[model samples]
Target: MLCGKSLVNNFYKYKRKVWQNVIPIIKRHNATYHPPKILFFGTDNFSLPSLQALHRNCSDRLGVVTSFKSPANCVRSYAEKEKLPLKKWPIEPSDCSQFDLGVVVSFGHMIPANIINGFPNGMINVHASLLPKWRGAAPIMYAIMKGDASTGVSIMKIEPHRFDIGAILAQREVVIKPDVFMPELHASLALLGADLLVDTVNNVQERLKEAKLQDNTNASYAPKITNKLTEVVWSELSAFDIYTRYRALFGYKNLTTSFLGKQVQLLELRIPERELLVQEPGTFKYQKQRKSLLIGCAQDSQLEILQLRVEGRKPMNAQDFNNGFLKGARSLNFTQNKLSAN
Candidate 1:
């Protein structure tokens, strides 16, 4: 009886081992079943880099769609240069019957609903912000403007006529450093988006099944930047706020202020160590010892100008600008012509 019991136990153990091996084989087969076709959309510098990276990595399964007009004209230029076969169409073209899935990075215009729904697998957008937080035009700039300690890239589904309200596929967080500028941040986010995109595509089935909806309550819009928005409001803002504004609008537009009946561009700025109790907001105070151009703000902190430009003049340091323009002038003016022309 004891020998018979031992034989039964061994037989049960052997059966369990066989089932364990078979289950993993079944799962592996399931995992290898399908790979979706992907379409890339965009034409700006940011989009171009990500698209190029995606094509290089997933050339066999990716297609590209871009605009045939100005601003997004680089799409055509890159396609010709790289010999990439691209489908060029106007922003609201009537037909989009080609792709199974779409991925938009920095496509300037809003994609119509028909084109978005044409993809059976659905479209995904790689936004530069954490989503539900910074949505709309300039997320990167908005994040920097808000002085966020950290920001991330989100891989979200494309929903028609909505602003970042789709389900999220994945997100990769990036830490914001004090010295990191806009160009560096932009590049980093683009690369992160490309990587996250590839991973999302690879795991589409599972991610789609487990997608999470974004919270609309936390949503905020980042409007498109303009010259008017770039004007420095010294009377209402602090030095740190001004500093962040400068970094956020750098490369795209220069921050402007009034000086001697002309708009003086605030090229580079820093916080002064010594506080001045006597200066009023928008007052220009020079620190020749530190070679700094100090502009007073609403708060105790001051904006130390490193470089600036006057109307019809090249950008110069505070000392050089002071020596040439600000010395003899009384109150400078921030005119529409002086601010917008450059």
Candidate 2:
């Protein structure tokens, strides 16, 4: 009896695993009975390329809804330039009842529950990171900053009044190289997202059967990017941390630090092997031999400056910055007296 019970338990476990793997595929297959008329919503450079791809590939069936003239606007401008059928609406309009599916790609705004429930097929979100892990704004940057080995895109069903809690229709893993920068990674993920989206839409029912529910217990939050997070805390972080910060904010935002009573933004940085004993953490050390600006960190590591921009000066290499700007720049003193005075 004991042996028989053990065998039955093992068989059930295996079946459970198979069921978990097969369910989403079955759901997606069932969902694809009708060719979905999609509304693509997003406004950002990241979303622009995907919009272009969808426009070129799925033009007959896809419509676009995007933000107005904002810093992050992507689809509206593209629609205007290409003269494509586009609607600028933060909320779903009265005529939105015609759309079958809502596919959101890098749309910054949090869609309301009413709009999510309006569609018969259901809304879908193309999240940058694997779901239930990095679910919120700035997933790519946060993933890099946290030094994740791999991140992926998730195609999830948007449920009413929920945040990233929908069933995942499909996902594709993306391996991060040690040397990959933020811009390149973002572009690669965006393209990958587009492909996954198309596949999910084409095989909707089969993919939905394979869709998996994320573990609520393991859920983590990715808050929106803020100026405070962009500021460099040199005294509390190591050189490697600083380097990651630089990469995370590159192009979109800058890693800012104060120097000589002026704020300087570091656009890029490298790490050198050579050690310096004199300069304190957060202080700048000029290496005449290597012509590098070695900035001391909270840890023993030294940050080799590659490119930097001063408060009012143009961006330049460490050597050029030293010669042109730092020649007259005073050393920042983070002492109590300096803090009190400032």
lDDT of 2 by residue, 1-342 (tens): 999999999999999999999999899876664457788888887787767777765666778888776854657878777877788767654545777778888877778877777776768888889888888888888888888899989989887666688889998998987667789899999999888888788777677778888888887777788877777666778888878877776778887776666677777778776566545677776677877777778766778777778778888877887777667656533221223234
Model 1 lDDT per residue over 59-140, tens place: 6666677887675477667776776667775433333455567788888767778788777777888899998889888999
Q: Please give the range of 10 consecutive residues that has the lowest summed lDDT in model 1.
A: 332-341
The superposed Cα distance between candidate 1 and the true structure at residue 29, in angstroms, equals 8.5
For each candidate in turn, the TM-score is 0.83, 0.81
Q: Candidate 1: where are CA atoms >4 Å away?
A: 1-34, 71-74, 91-98, 274-278, 331-342
TM-score of model 1 vs. true structure = 0.83
Model 1, position 340: C-alpha lDDT score: 42
Provide the lDDT at 29 for model 1. Answer: 84
Clashes of each: 5, 23
Predicted structure 2, TM vs. truth: 0.81
